[model samples]
Target chain A: MTNKECQWGGEERGILIVLSGPSGVGKGTVCSALRSMSKDLVYSVSATTRLPREGEIDGVNYFFKTREQFLSMIDNEELLEWAEYVGNYYGTPKAFVEQTLASGKDIILEIEVQGALKVKEKFPEGVFIFLLPPSIDELQNRITNRGTESEETIRKRMTAAVEEISLSEHYDYIIVNDKVEAACNRIRSIMVAEHCKKERYLPKIKKWIEEVL
Target chain B: MTNKECQWGGEERGILIVLSGPSGVGKGTVCSALRSMSKDLVYSVSATTRLPREGEIDGVNYFFKTREQFLSMIDNEELLEWAEYVGNYYGTPKAFVEQTLASGKDIILEIEVQGALKVKEKFPEGVFIFLLPPSIDELQNRITNRGTESEETIRKRMTAAVEEISLSEHYDYIIVNDKVEAACNRIRSIMVAEHCKKERYLPKIKKWIEEVL
Candidate 1:
């Protein structure tokens, strides 16, 4: 009964949580709030062939690479999932995510629906979460209020939002981003609950039983 | 979007949560706290073959029944789970639990390990929780301090507690009975998180998608 054994000693399995959403759904804000609360989680950085924007660090923001290097990665199947946009290629490097998880840290990959599907294919154990606006009207208002894009761009994004919302069924969890704090708390609760799963705690329980009995 | 549909329908599929612990581990206190916070949850009243001692109601406290009736239930397999103690049979009835769950109300069943295993065999989806004392020495002290049992009974119960703790591995979650409020809060959090699982919420997501798309 006085045993001080650290019961769960198997290789630390990392939780891979994918956050997917339509534009202007406040997914970024909710994720930021979650990050502020939990320091053990890491956000995955995407590798891209496009040039880095102003004040963006190469490895921190995006792992900027040449077109030849990106294509070579695809040829070698080193990328877990990849997609092309405009004239550049963007993909998640398999090694980075695997290493982060192996070290017992949770990793969040913020990707679009297409890329999210590919990631799920590559890592079947990853948790997929979809963020939604409270309503279509609220979605429109949010996009319009951002004022960062031209009216034409906003309209195009709105159309894409509709399509993305239609695919929310593919996600494991649907969080309505009506309020950032509430959404973050719900996500955090999910994380805590996952940790208490019987399968994950079985080894510890087995050891406790063997020693006591 | 404002439609408030009971996504699971009136065809309720409520969860059955089983709480078990050694005596003096504060299980009753924790259950009372949980009930106070979650008024919607129904605590299942068990049936017993023992004669009523005092002002106990048939349905509210225990469904006091004749020994022949209890034996008849056993023959008919109407009891979800039961056990014999001191020449009296105590058990949970199947009809009441099923009817309550079908009405969309969560149910809590407080029973011992044997009864828990029986219920698990019948309903594998049920949530099984084990309450643990802080330590073996503390458990001995708590039981001894109760002053209701003889020294021989105390020793017997302590040995039983050890055996029960050894079987804690079978439980889905283990709540340490350090503080009643904290344990109840964790239980509530687990319940809320279970509701958010993909298997339960996927239908709502699909319906929303089909309607909007």
Candidate 2:
């Protein structure tokens, strides 16, 4: 890092901010708000064997891949985390994340709790934030307000949310998704603060001191 | 600790932000800017055996104390860290800091690197930030700008700064003081992010889930 870049935001590796939460929490809304707030953050594109829906652009929306290509990627260990859902394979390509970080561009990964935990195992340094509904009642209201679901499905989802929230202890940070803007701001602050972490800049500072001072 | 307090600003114990750096690193300037930016942070007043200077208020500026009082406090372990300088004693009172934090009010302690390290030993959870000049040359310029010092004193201070900076590895974060506003922003973000730390809120979250969910 140059002396001018020493101010901040000059890290050689970008931070991976993983957003996860229970089903009813506003992780998607918060992530979208965060994306609008900062152009510096890049949203990680997922690679999937599922066919791209109409109006979806490859590489922009998802890295559309054939079943054989996805299987080859899995064999080569090119994916960070992969899941088989509804007979389709979906995964995050390790190459894009690693390249973005190497180029000093931060990437945001919004995934389920299990997927976020899987990412954590691969990249322990990633900042994992668990988005939470304001209250259990609030989560119930949100789940019910999505009127498309049956009562049985809502109950099942609520149980799943509680189970997912239990695993929140493994996350690095917890953000209550009471307000979308507030949650996004918390995420923004976390990103800024993570850059200031001692481990990220200490070696560079040490080298700078040795060479210049 | 409640559902209403589950958001980012609801930490039970206020954070202790300890700002420390080498001499001429603009720690004071950055701290002052931070104070102006947020009224939520309280400045920790030092207890001193030295007589209060003109216009200095008791308790507000410094907690004035007699030599006996200071010595007794030291013996009683009432002080977080103490130093005897120029025939007088000065120290941070552990009570005031603890009381402030327990009241859910964050306190800022701007001290020398040695004093900061001492506080860290006593309260390792404190957020230790090492402020740095943009570059070694900039640090030299800042030191030289203090026109009252002799050339010999300047050289001594430069040596001291280098030695002090070497201890920055012990700090939790590093902020380059290129601009006071920017440095203050980093500290603010750090304060915000620290509140979101999972360890601070996970227990409450778990209890909330158990009792309410």
Candidate 3:
């Protein structure tokens, strides 16, 4: 956004927010609360080859795609980051994200750690945040209590959670989800604080100095 | 302090805050408001060779020092940063600040630009913040209208203000003091957000991951 239109007084285009963690870390809930609180946040919809659920709407949930369409996107290099999970392809569309940010709106991409790292490779300026449960016991409780998954799947997910937690150090911020509201508040504070970082706002201040001096 | 003693959730020792700005930028007003708002913050008491005004208390206002003691502190390297101003020595006492932070209390040192850069050289981990007035006009008004200072002194201060503002790019955070309360709130946000930085809390999270896995 132009410096005049910036809410955080930054002269940069917009921030790309990348949120990642293991299953049942409450990324969806935190993002929901964040989007509800911030009117300017745009959620990046992932194009997936998985079939839609009974009531899930296309685009509103995932951008439902055939395997052929998803493969085509990958071949055309249109996806920011993508991976195959449980025989389904899931990836973030790059064009929409670029447009949204170019229009001066922040966009959040909720993905797994692998995808997150991949996106970071392509977009190093993105704010990468890894969300975690308060403790291992809490994470286990959440995963086991999600009822829809089989016991075998839960066991595998627990193993994966440990690996994901280990990779959190690579992210810019690691937020422990004690409560959705508190987690959201901390994320919002990070957003505000990042905007105030010296590098981001130096140009605007320099402009002010130029005018004043 | 041990990481376990930290209240902000990071394992690192309490943050050393370095606040610097031009003379007429209302640093005192903002700091007063900040102290009242955050009872947890400890203001670093500087040792000054200048005689204290009648009502100012020792240790609370300043650690009133004789010129000889001040020179001794310089020789002993007992000051984090020190400078001579108006024929008097004013400097942050190293012993008190290190002691307070060892007890897990955040200490804020308010100094000028040169002292701040010097502190950064010695303690590179400090969270340096440069405060600015809302506008040049407001800064001029504040300096010129301070009835206690002569016009020549005001002119000198204005010149210093420009130079200091130009050096702000080196600071970690920059806050514009439009209103004391707002400035205080932003500073508070920076404190909270700094605790969330991945680098600060990685070891703690790593311990958690090791135990959980």
- Report the Cα RMSD per candidate: 5.0, 2.4, 3.6
Model 2 DockQ, alpha carbons vs. true complex: 0.56
- List, for all models, the DockQ compared with the true complex: 0.28, 0.56, 0.44
- Residue pairs in collision within model 1: none
Poorest lDDT segment (10 consecutive residues) of candidate 1 chain A: A1-10
On DockQ, the leading prediction is 2
Q: Could you tell me the C-alpha RMSD of candidate 2 in Å?
A: 2.4
Error of 1 at B176 (Å): 4.6
TM-score of 2: 0.95
Tens-place lDDT per residue, model 3, B70-104, is 99999999998898889999998989888987877
Q: Which 10 consecutive positions of candidate 1 chain B have the poorest summed lDDT? A: B1-10
Error of 1 at B146 (Å): 7.1
TM-score of each: 0.78, 0.95, 0.88
TM-score (0 to 1) for chain B of model 2: 0.93
**Ranked candidates, highest lDDT first:** 2, 3, 1
State the displacement of the C-alpha of residue A16, model 3, in Å, after optimal TM-score superposition.
Answer: 1.8
| Best by the TM-score measure | 2
- Cα deviation at B99, candidate 2, in Å, is 0.5
Query: Which 10-residue window of candidate 2 chain B scores lowest in summed lDDT?
Result: B1-10
Question: Mind giving the per-residue lDDT tens digits that candidate 2 earns over B127-173?
Answer: 99999888778988999998888999988999899889889899998
Better of 2 and 3 by DockQ: 2
